[model samples]
Target chain A: MIVAEQKPFAEIAGFVADCNKILVAGCLGCVAVCLAGGEKETEILAAALRMHRRLQGKPLETVTYTATRQCDPEYVDAMADLVKDVDAVVSLACGVGVQYIAERYPDKWVVPALNTRFAGGSVAQGVWEERCGLCGECILHKTGGICPIIRCSKSLLNGPCGGSQYGKCEISKDVPCAWQLIYDRMKALGRLEWLLEYQPPKDWSKSRDGGPRKAVREDATI
Target chain B: MNLTTESRLEKLLKRGEFVVTAEIGPPQHASAHEIVHHARLLKGYVDATNITDCQTAVVRLSSFAAAVHILREGLEPIMQMTCRDRNRIAMQSDLLGAYSLGIRNLLCLTGDHQSFGNHPTAKNVHDLDSIQLINMVKRMRDDRVFACGEPIKEHEPRFFIGAAANPFADPFEFRVVRLEKKINAGAQFIQTQCIFDLERFSRFMEMVVERGLHERAYILAGLTPIKSIGAARYMQKNVPGMIVPEELVQRLRKAKDDGKNVADEGVDICVEFINKVRKIKGVAGVHIMAIAWEEIVPTIVQKAGLYPRPKAD
Candidate 1:
């Protein structure tokens, strides 16, 4: 899921301060699942904006709309009529959805109402934890399903560093040593020998180092 | 001022009867008008009214203003205060303001994080958590002084402070322990999150009673009727720590199949839930949250057989 945290109220207020006609768009995808950009959140943002506008004597003309998935072109097309009349669209979706709205309607201004955080899941009821780094690599099978890229402080591909003490990271007492976890998992699986296997450095060109990555399949394309 | 708020709460506590309370959501667009309307509708029917302060990370009319309006309408208002948006200084100032305005009851909470609220960019000032706020209130009441050691000649405002607990959210074993901590911090009452599992609540109560907390604190179970299958789904998915049991879903399904009024069915479900809750040992009361449907609260109270009581004095 594309996880995003809403920006502070004053920052959001300032972003759309110039627009008299505002469309507070919500995305019912990742942001909705995470309780960031959803129908309820959209209503909340609209109400707050209205109250702030009223307090400031601006008297904004605000309307709310939520697309099924703001990141997808098919779902974003649903907002064509809604976005046409509004002077600016304040998107409550993740960064992708905000950019999607901007791309879909080049004539109208699109502003992000949320600060996209990380791809994570709920660790507890209300607490979300970062899980994946989206570093354009998959090493879970070799690392016992734990992503070293995100969980590890150093993202070491080989083994536990000298700084690992008592299965804890050198950076903080709270963080469990990711390499230690990987070793323990490997030991449990009777594959401790895999840790000794030599692995080369990760290819940086395949990751964010490459400018604006894209994927296409000629056979799948309509 | 006819029915003293403390005496009324005390009467309910002493009787050990099933007390009923309702929520009053202030209008986002307008102020005193909606507050008074709901207050008048729910007056005398509910034991108290909870004036929510910007519930669900959304800004609304001030809870202080709504509480004052409820007071003028001859009803007790449980003023809901959050530690978000306000620093310790402003929180203390508001507490004093509410006290000076004759508002007595309080429900202290560590509000929704700024990330959850409408304005994401809003800087959250969580100077104190709910427990600390409760302790602060207790200190003000007992010592007649603020945390900064400012003294006043007059007695501090006597508030029946309450806090919230979610059994479904936290570990079951820790629920009672958390309650004990809140009670230790001087929480006179507790209004829990929405409870779908009465059996879980019963077990929680058993633990609470075993820990000897039943003697000191009044625990109120929260109940909000499900209007539709969609609403039920929404609550289960979005509301943090809220659990709507399978039985409730089945009841909603049955209501849908029977072609009965779904909204009325919702009230009937609430009535049934309240009846069951009232029978449970150590259960002090129930707080009904009829969000945006405050008018039906009186009907629910009447249906649940909690109406036509003498004015609490």
Candidate 2:
């Protein structure tokens, strides 16, 4: 899932300082699951913005709406009536959702209230850790189900690099060395010999190095 | 793998001489004065000098340019190349450029993370790891082909490839295996991380000797003389992949408390490490990384009886 964090209240307030009325939008997808931009979060943001404006010797109006999925055009089109009266739309969704809202109401000002971080799942209750590099190619079978592409600080193929100490990366003690994890996993699985084989240079053309990527599904298009 | 062209350090190591190499950190400014000064200081006392490449990811004069500066002073330079800043294309280009500029020895390394440097927000380009970088250089040199395996047609850069190892780092049992992997990837020599814990380094050498890895490539023990009690404490508590034993710190503290010169004690400790490691079987040479304290390298080399450096044929 794409994890995101809500922007600070002051920054969000500053974005709509020129506007007298605005709509606070939220999403029910990844952002909501990460407890960042759910329906409850949207109402709370809207109320807070209104109160903050009222205390500044000026009054402001705010309407709130939560989309089932802000990335889709249809869910964003549902907010057509709510956006007609507002000066700008403050989207609490990820970057994708902010663009969707902007595209739907091309005339109205649109701004993102959350910063989309990484494609990761919730590791603990409120903490999320990245697990994928989106490299467009997977080598999990060879690495004992550990992903070194995103986990290793150097993203080394035949790691751990000399900087791996005490099972942690040289960057920080908190970050576990990905190669250490791979080594332990491969050892447990009796696949230590697999690690001995040389891993050649990766063809990064399949990754972001190839430019913005897309997925095509002809079967589902119809 | 035996296709070397022009590296004095490589020749000395090949001749089984206990070579002594020291590092020269290029100035953060563009001045070449420090490189020349350090080169002159180390000329007769050491085999060759290593020009660090923006060590710790702090921006500085490039190692290639620094090597050229040192080479001008009649000293051979083991030019260090890190994988943190450049992609495969840029790295290959630099390899060709360095060779064309009369640079020979090349040390491949995975550079320190950018967060440790002044430019913390800079995006790192680890397109190739140190192992991959070594292999790429080998292909270009031994195979007479570029990293893409296309013909170089003429003048393929033949570098005396080197790589770094950290025996003190964890998954400690696997450090030796990693060294072997580096050797397999065509690293002609291995310069390990700084050693403060001689016991652990000795054990690491035992494993290297048992695997007979020492026979395949030259292994240089890395040494850094502690400058002061503060430096000792910093390396013990802060430096990554470093193991500074408590006894060494206590010795420095004892020296300071007794109103003795801490710097001299640091040099003594470094010379002691050099003497001990030289006695261990399969130890090829020593690479001293006295970062900002390049002056003490001459003293350490002299005190360790490694002076009057061998003239490589």
Most accurate candidate by TM-score: 2
Show the lowest summed lDDT stretch of 10 residues, model 2 chain B.
B1-10
Q: How would you encode candidate 1's per-residue C-alpha lDDT over A84-188 as one tens digit per residue? A: 899899999998898999999998899999999998898777678788878787889888888876776545554443334456764556778777688678778
* Model 2 residue B268 distance off true place after TM-score fit, in angstroms: 1.6
Docking quality level of the chain pair in candidate 1: incorrect
Q: Which numbered prediction scores highest in lDDT against the true structure?
A: 2
**Model 2 chain A lDDT-worst window of ten:** A158-167
Clashes by residue pair, model 1: A6-B120, A7-B120, A7-B121, A8-B120, A8-B121, A8-B122, A9-B121, A9-B122
The DockQ figures for the candidates are 0.02, 0.76
**Interface root-mean-square deviation (Å) of every model:** 18.9, 0.9
Candidate 2 structure, TM-score to reference: 0.97
TM-score of chain A considered alone, across all candidate predictions: 0.94, 0.96
True contacts kept of each: 0.00, 0.64
Question: Taking the tens digit of each residue's C-alpha lDDT, what string does model 2 give over B83-105?
Answer: 99999999999999999999999
Cα lDDT tens digits, model 1, B1-313, are: 3222353665666666568888988888765888888888887888889999998668898999889889999888889998776756788889889988888889988676455567867766555556667877877887777756687558576677888876665334545665776788778888887778888888888898888887888888888876778888777656545667777877888888999877888888888888998877777888999888899888888898888644554
